[model samples]
Target: MIKEAIYHRPKDNFAYAYDKETLHIRLRSKKGDLTKVSLIYGDPYEWNDEGWKNSKKTMTLEGTDELFDIWFVEVKPKYKRMRYGFEIKSNENFLIYGEDGFIEKDPKNAHFYFCFPFLNENDVFNAPAWVKDTIWYQIFPERFANGNPLLNPKNTIPWGSTEPQFDTFFGGDLEGIINNIGHLTELGVNGIYLTPIFKAKSNHKYDTIDYMEIDPQFGDKKTFKKLIEVCHENNIRVMLDAVFNHSGFYFEPFQHVLEYQEKSKYRDWFHLRDIKVKALPEANYDTFAFTHLMPKLNTENEELKKYLLEVGKYWVEEFDIDGWRLDVANEVDHQFWRDFRKTVKSVKPDAYILGEVWHDSMPWLQGDQFDAVMNYPFTQAVVEYIAKDEINSEVFKHKLIKLLSNYPKNVNEYNFNLLGSHDTPRILTLCQDNKDKLKLLFLLQFSFIGSPCIYYGDEIGLTGEGDPSCRKCMVWDKDAQDTDLFTFLKKLIDLRKRYSAFGANGQFEVIESAKETNHIMYSKKTVEEQIIITINNSNSALKVHLPFDISKNESMNLWDNKPQKISEIEIEPLSFSIIKL
Candidate 1:
């Protein structure tokens, strides 16, 4: 046995409370090193004269990555606490692994076992239930539409007349969003995540001049309230973006600091390297990524923290917004976010708090700071496999399995999954304008776990390379839109809403990944039903065989709504099939 490769811990993803009564335990071993593994667990206080009485339950091999095999098992401790150890076996060796490390035989002592002292319900990681079911549509306010051209800013250009520039504006406002409520409803989207809309000098509004007021280009508070009312009437939730990490150079306090330097009362509000602050010839003060215009806020300051906390509560307490997507959340202090959560939840207990983190965010997702983070790792994996063609099906499966293992199941459900946003190249552009490849990408995204988002024009075949180009005016001409792609996305959303097994309620497992054929098959299973999805990423047709006998059981092809009994299914190039049994 490879003793050095075996590992486990009693907290976080290794072992955690799945709910009030269940505990999930996992073990890691060198790939293909162990033939079998089982958990030997019991309440620490339940020991009698029989040398620490315990029960053994087998752990199933969850998945195998490049170097390790993850084993998992769920247990319900009779006393709500557990002392556990693992019994590992290979063809030539057997051993007991525990808190003290490997041993030749069972120690029969509770001290040698790993301990989970108790399971506290309040400590469980709980995000809002509504988030898991939501299908989010992200809107960049300045580019979506112009319902009331009267609110247009000075020098606002005609919508879609030219390619977007960094400083250009098309006068999209909240009234435009209210006018197009039918667009979201017809597409079956239940949530809309709007980019930063607070008063700012720029069209994107990430640099906040004021947090308490809506930008005039997006209308006043009354118009925003009406937009909220309309969205609620149509059963669509709204999440607004907030940029608390920095302030625009034109912001009053920032301007004051530039004018008065160290003498300003707001001098401590920002991270100024020297008493003499300057924005030209390289800023002496700290900023967001060295940008002269955006000065990073000192969130540790008590006065500034109080102001931001109020901003967090005001939206929920006054306008009744459904959620807040924190921009540059990873850059903020942990204590500030903790206080932010308490303040926001004080007014609305179930309000979703999503963070913008591009990497592993286990530190902020412990049921304290963020409900979830923007799942950029997922975006990268999908882009690499489908858009860049840099990885085969087998490598893609491995990457996904490893990602799934990094968090608890509940956290995975609330992850904000997006293909392309205002930050990256559009999905269609990334797929090289191949609608077939894009279709396959959407199939995997909507079927996989998490709350998926659709960028403003992604469903209608919008294509652009990156930042300023990705943020373009919304294409409203129905005759020019890709109607076929729109229909495909609408069907996927409808099926997600209609079926439980095809959504977040099911467990995901890899059925097969064929590198030679560039094909993959996976299943989402629940107690009552199972959904199997097959995809062919190559240019040639291929036949994928089911692992088990399906000749006797009745099955239906969910995509076409037709009954099929074939044990082997033929899939077309750059396409997929959803089968329900």
Candidate 2:
């Protein structure tokens, strides 16, 4: 046995409370190293003259990645607290793995086992329950629609009149969003994630000049309120972007600092080197990504923290917005976010607080900070395999298994999964304009766990490169739109909503991943039903075999609504099938 490869911990992903009563424990061993594993656990205080009184539960092989095999088991402790250890076995070797180290046999003392001291109800990570069922559509306000062209900014070009530039605007406003609520409803998304909408000089609005006021270009507070009303009426929740990390150059306090230097009262609000604070010839003050125009805020300042926390509370208290997507959230101090969560939840207990974090965000997702982070790891894995073709099916499965094992199942359900965003190339463009590949991408995204988000106009085949370009005007012309692609996505969304097994309620399992055929098969299963999906990423047709015998059981092909009994299924090139049993 490779003792060094065995690993476990009593907190975070390895072991955590899935809910108030249940604890999910996991153990990782070198891939294919262990033949069997089981959990030996009991309340720490429960003991007898013979030894510590405990029960053993066999652990199921959850999944295997490139280097590790994950074992999982769920237990509801009789006393809500327990000490646990693993009994691992290879062909002829046996070992007891615990908090201390490898042992020849189970120790009679509970101190030798890993301890989940207590399962406190307050410690359980609780994101809003509504998030599990939501399908999010992300909208860049300036590019979506122009319902009232009268509100257009000076020099605003005609919608979709020319290629997008950094400073260009097409006059998309909240009124436009209200006018096009049908588009979202028709697309089957239940949530809309709008980019930053507070008053700012730029079209993108990430550089906030004022946190409290809505940008006039997107309409006044009344129009925004109406937009919220309309969205809520249509059963679509709204999530606005919050840019608290930095302020635009034209932000009043920033401008005051630029003018008065050392004398400005807001001097402490920002990070400054010398009092001069010149933007030209390289800025002496800290900024977001060294951009001279966007000055990073000192969130540690009490006054500034209060102001930001109020901004968080105001939207939910006043407008009844469903959520807040924090931009550059990882850059801010953790205390500020904790306070922000407290403030926001004070007004509305279930308001979703999503953070923009591109990497592992376990620190911020402990139920105290962010409810969830933008799932970029999920995005990267999908893009690498489906869009870029940089990885085969086997490697893709490995990456996804690794991602799923990183967070608690509850956190994974609310994770904001997106394919393309304002920061990356459009999905269709990334797929090299291959609609087939794009369909496969959508199939995996909507079927996998998490609250999936669709980049505006991606369903209708809007294509572009990175930022400025990715932020293109929403294509409204039905004749020109890719209706076929839109219909494909709509069906996937419908499946996600109509069946529990096809959505977040099910457990994901990798059935098979064939590198030679470049095809993969996976299943989403619940106690009542199971959904099997097969995707062929290769150009040639492929036949995928089911692992178990299903000849006697009745099965239906969810795509075409036809009954099928074959254990082997053939999938066309760049296509997929959804089978329900």
Candidate 3:
């Protein structure tokens, strides 16, 4: 046994309450070091004259990263408290491992083992239940559709006339979204995430001029209200973007600072180093990424805090919005987000609060701030293995295990997973316009554990580079669009909803395949069925052999529902199939 390789903590990711009654525990050991591990647990006070009363359950090998093999088990204690330890078995000998270190035999003293003082309901990480089961559709609203071109700004070009530029507008508005609810309904996604729709100076709407009003190009309050009513009537939930990290240069408070310099009452709202300064290059105030046009706000100021908190509450209370996707959330202080979560949930208790964080997000996901983050790590890993061919199947599996282990199980269920967004190149472009590779990427994404999102027009084979190019106007002409890609997306969405193992809250296990190094296989298990999803990312067809005997097990291919055998399987190059066993 590699004694130094064994690791576990009393709290955090290693051990935590999954819910009011269930506690999840995990252990890390050197890869393939221990042959088996059994959990010995019981109530802290459940003891007799002989010794502490306890029960033992074997732990299963969950998965492996680069250096460690994770072992996990869930226990429901008769009482709400627990004292537990591990019994590790190796080829040579068996040893007892506990808080007190290695021992020759099981200790009669319960104090020698790890302890969870209590399982309080208040400490449970409670995210919105609906979020786990939802498939989201993200819209870059200005380029989604054009219901009324009369509302277009001056110099508006024809719809999809040319590649999108930073200043070009395609005249998309709330009325346009209202006109296309059928498209969303038919696509089978239940949630819509529209990027910044508030009053703003730029076509993208991230530079907010007014936090309370809808941009004139999009529509007025009444038109937005009608849009929301219609969306809800069709059983679709709407989530708006909140850009509280900074405001547009022409915003009233910032304009007051510009006019009055040091004497303005709103001077404290911004971080200014000098009183006399102008323009982006010369401005002495802190801004968003050195762009003086979008000045960063001092959320610590009491008056500024009140204004922003009201902005958070107003949409939920007035518009009946279902959720808020915060912009530049990591740059803001944690206290402000805590208050934002409280304010939004006060209006609608089940409202989802997602943050725009691209890195490790443990700080903001403790049940008091953001429910989940953008999950960019998931995106990068997929691109590296499937699109760029920069990493092999083993490396991809290792990266995914590390990513999934970074959060609690509940947070993983609600994570906002996406392949491409307005900020990145389209999926087809990332795959070098390879249709088979794109299909494989979608299969892996929808089958993984998280809430998945699709960028608008990505379903219809939209392809472009990053930023402005990725924000092209939606293709409304059915004849001009790629019907094959559209049908593929619709069928993928239907399959995700039809399978119980694909449920957000179900069991997932990655099975390592030694026969095919370029292939990845994982299983999704529910109470009624077990499914094996295999993908071949290489150029040559790969042969896959099962690790277990399924000679008598009933099996079928999930993609086309064709019968499959349990013997060695063959996967075509850059293609995937799901087998129900």
Q: What's the lDDT of the predicted structure labeled candidate 2?
A: 0.93
* Position 109, candidate 2: lDDT: 82
Which digits, one per residue and each the tens of the lDDT, describe model 1 over residues 38-120?
A: 99999888767778889999999999877889999999999899999999999999999999998988888989999999999
Error of 2 at 267 (Å): 1.6
lDDT (Cα, tens digit) per residue for candidate 3, span 51-149: 998889999888888999888889998888999999998888698888988887888779889999899987778888888778899998899988887
Error of 2 at 508 (Å): 0.5
Each model's lDDT: 0.92, 0.93, 0.88
State the local distance difference test value for candidate 1: 0.92
Query: Which stretches of model 3 miss by more than 4 angstroms?
Result: 50-53, 91-105, 275-279, 514-517, 548-551
Pick the lDDT winner.
Answer: 2
Query: Model 2, 346-442: lDDT tens per residue?
Result: 9999999999999999999999999999999999999999899999999999999999998988889889889989999999999999999999999
Better of 1 and 3 by TM-score: 1
- Candidate 1 at residue 301, lDDT? 95
